[model samples]
Each structure stands twice: as structure tokens, then as C-alpha cells.
Target chain A: MAFNTGAALMDALVLSVVSNESTYGYKITQDVRSVMDVSESSLYPVLRRLQKDGCLETYDREFAGRNRRYYSITEKGVDQLEDYRVQWREYAEKVDRVLFGGIDDDKN
Target chain B: MTKTEFLSRLAEELKGISAEEREEALNYYSEYLDEAGEENEEAAIEELGGPEKVARIIRANTAQSAQGAQPAAPKAAAEDPFGAAAQPVPPSSAYAQGGQSAQQAQSGPAYTQSGPDDTQSGPAYAQTAPGAPHIPYEGYEAPRRRSYLWLWIILGVICIPVIIGLLGAILGLIGGVIGMLASLIIGGATAAFAGFGLIIKSVFLFSSYPAGALFMMGGGFLTGGLGVLACAFGIWLIRKGVPFVASSIRSGWSYLKGKVRDLRWND
Candidate 1:
């Protein structure tokens, strides 16, 4: 589904993706693209923002004779992810209730 | 585009970002392309979109996070959230959005916003605030006006002597020519008159006329002295006229030299 992801949501998504395991930029972009129709270019800024906010950390590793940068989620990032989950649950339910009849109710 | 071309374009697009942040961003993107593999470079670039849009996202993200970090200091946050966190970013994005000239014009306001505290200080704030009538006090123009007066004085001093000298030289040249012509005419006439008187005196003496010879001799002597006196006066005119012309020329040259020296000193 196509959706305009807000900054908070983008940050949360990046943090959650990295929280799974430390991953390189291309892999993270591919993972995020599975759910959202965001340009790969848009992910870098979100990654930078999460890093700046202490929710992410980065390190360089060599693979195939070239340097590759990997991003990992920090404790702060996990905390931020928890907050985003709670907020997203409430927000999604509200948006779903308005768009559809009710998120869990039967529809005819 | 090739990886090199894409990275360079991205770097060019991110003009206002700090060196360290820009390096990090570039490193991230470079590694991203590398991870995409050589064969997928083109596809990766196409998926990322243009460098300009990417730069905008990065700049916006940096600005937003900076604001988030310091929520308490509203004043500093308002002054320049982007510049305070990252190195000052010039309004190059305006160029990316518009064109070169438009970006140049926008840079001024962007700088004013990101400039030193003096620009945001109380006095400047009051003067620039909307709906405030700007009234310059009496002393406001003092320094600049006084400098203008000094400039005029120096220019006048340098120019007046040259003007006067030029006028004098022109007048002196004309007067000297006229004086030389007049002196030539007067000297020739007196000399002719003296020669005639001498000839008459010689004729009277040869003819044995005592009284007439004496009268002619007296007239001849008197005419000879008058011719000599006229010649002397002409010589005097030549001497005085030449000096007057020379002095005027010398004065004009000295004034010109002085003007050159003053210009050099000012430089």
C-alpha cells in the first residue's frame, strides 16, 4: 500500500529495522521498501536523524574488497521503538475506525 | 550514471552541509552503491531519485533533529536550528529548487537568519521589526558625511592649483607672443629712425654746413640712444616673459606630481 510516511514513523521504521540486526544501508532500504513506497534516497536522512537522536549507531566493515557501512539500534533506539509502537497502535486504530466502519467490527 | 558520477553529483548537491556530516552521508551512500554491486549501480541510482531531493531530506532531517535536541532554548532554536547542529548550510537548496540566480538572492536572507547574535540582538531587532518607522537621528550621518567633506577638501586642494596654473600658462603664452611681435616692430622702427638721423648728420658734415651738421649730430645722438633704450626694453620683455611662462609650466607640473603622490598615498 502507498502511504506518505511522517518523520516520526520513518524514524520508528528505521530503528525497528535496524533493531532486528545490524544491517547495511542497501539491505535496510530494501526491508523498509517492502511495506512503504519510499524512495531509497529518503531513508538515508532518516538514518542520519536516528543516529543523531542516539537511537542508532554505525560502523564500517569491509566486504568484497570494499568498505560497507552498517547501522545498529541502541538501547535508546529500542526505547524510542517501544514508544512509537504504542503511539502507532492508537493512531492506527483511530485512522482505521474513521476509514472503515471499525477496525475489528464485522462489515456488510 | 556511474558510481563516481552519482557520488560527485550528490556531493555537489549537498553544498551547505558540514564537512564531517557530509563525509558521513557520502560514506553511507557510497557504501550503499557498493553493496548494491557493480551491475546494480544504475538501478540503485534510479531508485534513490535525484541528488537534490536526497539533499533536501538530509537537510530537513538535520534541522528537525537539532530542534528536537534543544527544546528548552527557544531563542537559539529559532535563530538557526539547521546551522547550530550542522555547519551552516547556505541556501543552495534554493538553487536546487529554482536556479542559480534565485539561490543567490535567497542566500542573503538565509545568512541574516544564520548570522551572528548581533543581528538578533535587541537594537537590531527593534529597527528591523515590521511596522516600526525608521527615524535616523542627527548624528546618524555624522561619520559618513564628515568623510565626504574631507574628500572634497582634498580634491579641491589638489585641483585648484592645476587649474590656476593652466589658466596662467595659456594667458602667458598669448601675452608673450603679442609682446614679442610688438617689441620687434617698435625696435625696428626706432633703429630705422636712428640710421636715418645718422645719414643726415653725415651729409651735413660733408657739405661743410656747421650749424646743420651740429643739429643733425645732436638729433642722431638722441635717436641712437632712444633706439638702444627700445632695444633694451625689448630684451627686458623677453627675459621677464620667458620666466613667467616657465614658472607657470613648472607650477602645473608640480601640481600634477602632487596629485599623483596623493593618489598613491590614498591607495
Candidate 2:
């Protein structure tokens, strides 16, 4: 894509992924990368940032006789996601207006 | 390389961070590799861009949390992150380890030797002390992301108020100077009017007392001349004042507009 996703967008995507179900680091990265061109190793810092900011929490879940760290969205993370959605909606609408200024049949 | 080699190198690269952070990072990476299973382990490692890059990312986060004054995580991160002091390590993540580097890693042994509670994965753990003091690096580039845009936005947001306050102060100062000049012009006019009145009085006194009339005339001319000079000076200042104030406001507005452009919101 020509456009680069900003930090807010990335944060929103990560939070959204975890919001659906508690998952592990590898899964989160894979899901996020499926949509955007993000580096595989990039999600760790984002996870750590959100974790410290109290947006996400991690816990150990046993799988195949090994512990896999699972991350679940917190209340703060949900609120942050909501905020991102609102802002993104507004942003997308504005961009659409500028790009499709002559699409006169559009209704709000 | 195998997951063990990747993780051991990563642990080595993250040698300076807090033990708590290091151990968590190791567990996370180790789990990541295991989750990939034997078949995709090489691909996973390759996707990670090797352990060096992963270690760099972890270290960068550690620095950021250290200086950011974040709770439970010591403060740090700018372009460079701070190395948080050794947080008390928890031994829980160390469970269910393979026969990886459980015995031969040097850094892990040093850490476990000092740690009252050590875990099983030797190579995965980085050396850290309980009270390890934070050493913040200056201007360390943040993680490889587009977050610098966000940082710039934040910085602009913080500086906006300060810039406005300074602009207000400068405008006020210019307004005060202009105000004083206006008053001076009025005062000069008043003095000139008084001097004219004195001169007319002197004319009236000329017939009755020549000496007194002469003295009054001399005083009137001196006062009139000083008043005119003051008036001229005030006018000159006012003439210069308009462009000076306008340019100041223009520059301030220009700077403010540039800042706003960078921080353009949807609203």
C-alpha cells in the first residue's frame, strides 16, 4: 500500500485482534501482519507498551505441556480501541470527501 | 539456526536490561518458536530477522519504559531507551523447557548464581541484579515502526501552549510600547498647547513689563521646541511600531500554522 499505517492505527489493530479472544504473541503478530506490512518482531514492543500502559494484560496458559503467554484486552484497551475507531472513521470520511469530492450522489 | 541458538543470542544481546524483562522476553520468544513447531521454526527465526534485531527491539522497549516514569517499569525511552534496573525475577516462565541451553550459557549461570530464585533455561536469561540502577541512553531510535509520526504529534501538542503563551507575551509587550508612545504623543501636544498659552501671555505682558515678557517668550520657545521634539519622537516610534508588531504576529502565526498543519486532525 502507498499509505503507511500510523502508530494509532497499529495500536488499534492489535487491540482489536486481542479483544476478540485471548491469544499469544505469535498469533497476535500473525493476525496483525495479515492485514498490514509490519515486521514480525515489531509487535513485541507494542505489546509491552500496551501492557505497561495498562491497556493489555498477559497470563500463562498451558498448551502441549508448555506455557504459552496469552494476552487479553483490558477495559482500557477496549476504550482505546473505541477511540481509535471513532477517529479513524472521521479520518476516513474526510479523506473520502477530498478524494471523491465529485461523487455527488453520496449520502451521509 | 535453531530456536535455542536464536534465543541464546537474543539473551546475550539484551544483556543490560532488567532480569524480569529479559526472562519474559526469553519465555515469549521461546514460546513463539515452539508455537511455530519444528517445521516452521527456521521460517519463524527468519521472519524475526534473526536474534540480534529482536534483542534490539526488546532493549529499546526496556529503555522506553524505564524513563517514561511508567509504574512498576523504571523510566526511560526516547530515540534511545533506558536500561531498567533488575526487577525481581519470577521463576514461573522458566517452566517446561527443552534440553536447549539449560547448562552451558555463561550469562545465564551468572544471573542464576546471583538470583535467589533461578529458572531452568540457562541461555534464555540475561544477567541482572535486584537493585540494578537505570542507565538511560540519549536519543536512541525507537523501535522500527511509524510511531515517530505519533511522537512528533505529541511533541507538537505539548509545545503548542508554550508557543502561544510566548506569542501572547510578545504581542503584549509590543502593545505596551505602542501604548506608551501614544501617551507620550498626547503629553507632547499638551505641553505645546501650554507653551502657546504662555507666549500669548507674554505678549500681553510686553507692554507692562518688557523684561518679564522677554523671559516668558524665551521660556515659551524652549518648551514649544521640546514638546514638538517629543511629539515627533512618539510619532516615529508609532510608525516603526506597526510593522514590528505585524511582523512578530505574522511570524508567530506562520509558525503556529506550520505546527497545526503537521498535527492536522480530522475535525
Candidate 3:
């Protein structure tokens, strides 16, 4: 029943992928599925939220026999993603430190 | 079965599901058709589940996903499919399942899919097709909502000088304390009497000449009053909303130009 795990992380990851170049919906969905456990339910909302916040822009491209929506990063989006990345990295490190204990001294 | 047929049936089956879920189910079924080959509806359907059983599973999964997303809704509200606040979940299979929050935090929450029926209550947005036509941001030109505090601050700023002037008048009535003390201490009876008389005369003059007294009280009151008025006017201008601000900003720019012209001419 606990569905919040890695949910926010997925949005951050999606932003990272879209930040690089224009990507279609299917590709983004597939990419998330390949690495981590992202429900299709989560991706749509994240995309909508990002668009609403002016972080990303979308256009349509012909794919297969139909037109598919393609998402691209905006300057605003890049800035937001950078902010998220900074926060996420710090958070990840802190989590790692606490969960694994002793800061994984091997990296040092 | 053809990909189109398979997708059509999947869509039909997932009618109560969110657009995201529906699209996902279609995509998944399409992928299955591609992988498992055509002429295998029975096999694919079997693999997924019988239509009724699949519907039940989809319902259960969607409910679970929705519950996962929105912890705030009541159990009755939770069960209401097509309620505008809950997420229209299809099944966990529609996406990678189970990455929900460990503890549902109140802030920075995700959007829960609400069905159409309850859309009026909560913030409801449709799962738009990726290439859906963009509805023009109609109110983009409209002004934003602002706090009423700015108006109050402007009014308070304007009142300061008036308050100071009133205090000054009260002191003038009380033998101009500084003048009375100085005259009595420095020059004894004669000076003190003169100072007291002068204070009485000033009070009488102020009582007779309200306008002159106010003017003598100086520009503080005027400045404060104008400041307050300007703030009130500013709030009024802003209250007309963003479109008003946009137009007024242009006018204000021209006013600035005219003021600059006046300043140059005066110089």
C-alpha cells in the first residue's frame, strides 16, 4: 500500500532525461520503467506538473503511423532540474550516510 | 488479434480508468501483441485475466494506487470511482508498481486522479493526451491576487505625519513646554510671563486659523496623507486586476517621462 517510495525521485529522473533532448511520451515511460519502479500513473502527473510549472514544453512528432507527443526542456525547466538535482544529491548522501552508516568511507 | 483491436478492447475495458492509465494499458497491450504475436486474444486475455476478472483486478489496483496517492480522502470518497479528486487508477501493471511514500507528508504532494463527478470540489485536471491542443492561457494578461496588507501599510504610512502634527498641536496648547521651561529657567518672572503669553497667543491663533495651523504643522501631514492616498489608489489600481496593471504600467512609464521632462525644464 505504501506507494510514496521513489515517487518523487521518478519526477527528478524524468526531468533529467527530458533535460538532455526532446523525447516522446513512450520513450520517457519506457526509460523510467527500465531503471526503477515507476508506475504509469506517476509519470503522467509528473509530466503535467512539470508543464504546468513552465519547466518543460511539448510538441508533437510523427512516430510509427501516428503523431506522438514529444517533451523538451525549457530554460526554466533546466534551472528547476538543476535545483532538484542539487537537493536530491544532498538528500541521497544523507540517506546513504544514515542507512548504510559511516558515510561509505570507501568513496573517501 | 491486431494491435488496433487489442488496444480498442483494452481501452473499452479500462473506461473508468484515468487517461494516463488507459494510455498505459493500451501501450502495454500493444507491446504484448507485438511480442506474443497476433491471433492470440484468448491467450493474451488469459495471460492478463478474463475480462470480468481483469476488470475487477484493474478496479482493485486502481483503488489501491489512488489510495496510495491520496491519503486524505475518506473511505467513501476513496471508493467513489469517477470522483473528481481521486486518481483514476487502472492497475499496477499500467506502470511500474509500488513506489508510494513511506509516510504521507502533507506538503509537496502528488496529484491524485479524481473522477469527473467530483471535479468541482478539488483541483481537477484531465489527463491530457500529450499532443492535445493547448488551450490559450486566457487570463495570462489578468493581474494576480495580492494581499490586502499593502493597502493597510500605505494607509498607516500616510497617517504618521498627521499623528505627529496632532501631538505638536497638543504640546503648543500646554505652554509650548520647551519654550515655557527655557524662558522661566533662563530669565525668571518676566521671561516666563512672556513665554506663557506667547504660548496662549499661539494656541488662540491655531484655534482661529485651522488651515494656517495645519500648514504650519508642516508638510508631514500632507506628505503622509498623499502617501496614504497613493497607496489606496495603488491598491485600487491593482484591484482592477493584472490587465489594469499592464495598461497602467505603460501609462506610468509615460508619466515618468513627463516628470523627467518637468525636472529637466525646472533645472
Q: Per-residue lDDT of B147-239 in model 3, one digit per residue for the tens? A: 234655788799999989998897786555445444433444343344445445555668789777555444444444444454455455445
lDDT of 3 at B83: 27
True contacts kept of each: 0.29, 0.25, 0.01
- What lDDT does the true structure give each of the candidates? 0.62, 0.67, 0.49
How much is B190 displaced in model 2, in angstroms? 63
Each candidate's number of clashing pairs is: 0, 15, 21
- Candidate 2 or 1, higher DockQ: 1
lDDT of 2 at B80: 10
What is the descending TM-score order? 2, 1, 3
Tell me the TM-score of each prediction against the true structure: 0.45, 0.47, 0.34
> DockQ values for all predictions?
0.13, 0.10, 0.03
The alpha-carbon lDDT assigned to residue A79 of candidate 3 equals: 78
lDDT of 3 by residue, A34-90 (tens): 765433334554565567558878886565565566789999888766766776666
Candidate 1 lDDT over residue span A1-108, tens digit each = 212233355556778899989998899988987776556776776677677768899898888888887899999889878877776776676667766766456554
Alpha carbon lDDT at B254, candidate 2: 97
